[model samples]
Target: MQPTFQNIQEAAQRIAPLIHRTPVLSSESVNHISGAQLFFKCENFQKAGAFKMRGAANAVLSLSDEEAARGVATHSSGNHGQALAKAAQSRGIKAYIVMPETAPSVKKKAVAGYGAEIIMCKPTLQAREDTLAEVVKRTGAEFIHPYNDERVICGQGTAAMELIEDTTALDIVMAPVGGGGLLSGTAITTHAMLPQAQVIAGEPQGADDAYRSLQAGKILPSESPNTIADGLLTSLGTKTFPIIQELVSEIITVSDEEIMAALRLIWERMKIIIEPSCAVPLAAVLQQKEKFAGKKIGIILTGGNVDLEALLSKF
Candidate 1:
């Protein structure tokens, strides 16, 4: 069955002790600059350095005993791979991760450090999937998708639950959109609990599939994304696209420069490090300040798995 609020709640209960309840921070400086009352859900501090842990742990733990023994396999760019590797290790299950050849070395080392086997592939989604398929077929491992599963979505929804619980009556909640796992789950949970809360998604301008898809009223595939927000390069998944289309109030786009600026702002003002992908929502707010002025807004700082050297060189 598709993930619902009930399913997400159950997942939250199941994974509560395993994951951090990460703090919700407020910044008057950010509010003053953007003219919006901002509540930041600091998922960059989450375990595995991203919100991916919620779903990865849920998917790993939900597996049948037989499936667990067979182990788990998946494809990810970085954060999800590390999350799955760590979650699988916690359950004493071996994990096989397929990552792009061009994925950040820092992330690749983290996944390997978690004791998961790594298989490198070309930078295409198709290549990653094919490699994962072969690995799963060879080892008879359970396939744990990075985003396209009900259990994964349910796990991701918990982030939204915690955000709303921490602060009440938000005018809107914004999350970065990649495969749509986080946004889809946020939509389900937020709509069920805070029906008045509008859930918006932020996408990079260079990889604006989610924004274009929402605007066109159909699934729009990204064509060779060239964005610096490496984590937001993927198109929406089949399961997540329909849910996002139904539940998200809007999908906004932010340029790569704007994303970098937002990233720098978070680091300088909040004293927190966030990757470009994680800064998309904050970038949106900065770019469209008038629309969010004087309103209570919640933004998810999705992850912090940036390569410091690359970031430094860029600036």
Candidate 2:
């Protein structure tokens, strides 16, 4: 069944004990920098070190024992892979993660630490899907898409549910869009809880497919997404795109340099480590501070999964 508000609510209740109710942080310095009263939902501190844990837990837990016995499988190079591995571990089920060979070794280690099997593939999306299919065929495991499935979407929405519940009177709420799961889930939850709040999405200019998709009234895949935000490279999913098209008020694009600036600013001002993907919304807001000035806004810090040593090379 396609996820609805009730599904999101149910997902929250189901995963409450399984996942962390990560803190909503704030910084007067960051607020001053962006010219907005910013509430940062620190999902970087979540179980499995990303908000993906919420959705992954819900999906795994929602499966019946018979189905779970067959386990679950998905293709993700970063946080989703780790989240699914952790979720499967909690449920005592096998998880097969199809990762690109080029994916960071740290992420692979994290997924392995959760006891999920790793299946490497070529870096292309097609290669990842093909590899995942073979894993499912051999294991008879249920396929759990990283961002496209309804259960996953509903699970992702819980972060926004927490954000809106924790912070009052938010004028706007924005999340970074990759496959649109988090952004769409956020829009669904935010609109349902705070109808007055505007929902925005941030996209990397290198992978501005979501913005183009919204304008075109259709899902448009990015031919090649080249950005430092490795997590935000995939185009929107079939299930998630419609929700984003209908609910998102604006899709803002930010450059890699702008994302880097935001990344440094947050680390310096808030003393929190966030990945480039997590910094997209803040970068978009800061890029157009005049539009967001004086507004009470919420930004979802999606994850902190990154190679700090490699990241430092950029500076």
Q: After superposition, how far is residue 76 of candidate 2 from its true place, in Å?
A: 0.4
- Give the clashing residue pairs of candidate 1, or none: none
Which residue pairs in candidate 2 have backbone atoms (N, alpha carbon, C) closer than 3 angstroms, thus clashing? none
TM per candidate comes to 0.98, 0.99
Top lDDT hit: 2
Clash count of each predicted structure: 0, 0
User: How many steric clashes does model 1 contain?
Assistant: 0
Candidate-wise lDDT, in order? 0.92, 0.93
Candidate 2: worst-modelled 10 consecutive residues by lDDT: 1-10
In Å, residue 190's CA in model 2 sits off its true spot by: 0.7
* Cα lDDT of model 2 by residue, 118-176, tens digit: 99999999999999989999999999999999989999999999998899879999999
lDDT of each residue in 1-315, candidate 1, tens digit only: 568899999999999877999999987787898889999999989999999999999999999999999999999989999999999999999999999999899999999999999999999878998998899989999998888899899999999999999997898988999999999999999999889989988899899998998889888899988898999888888999989989999988999999889888889889988888988998999999988988899888888888998879999
Candidate 1 Cα deviation (angstroms), residue 294: 0.7
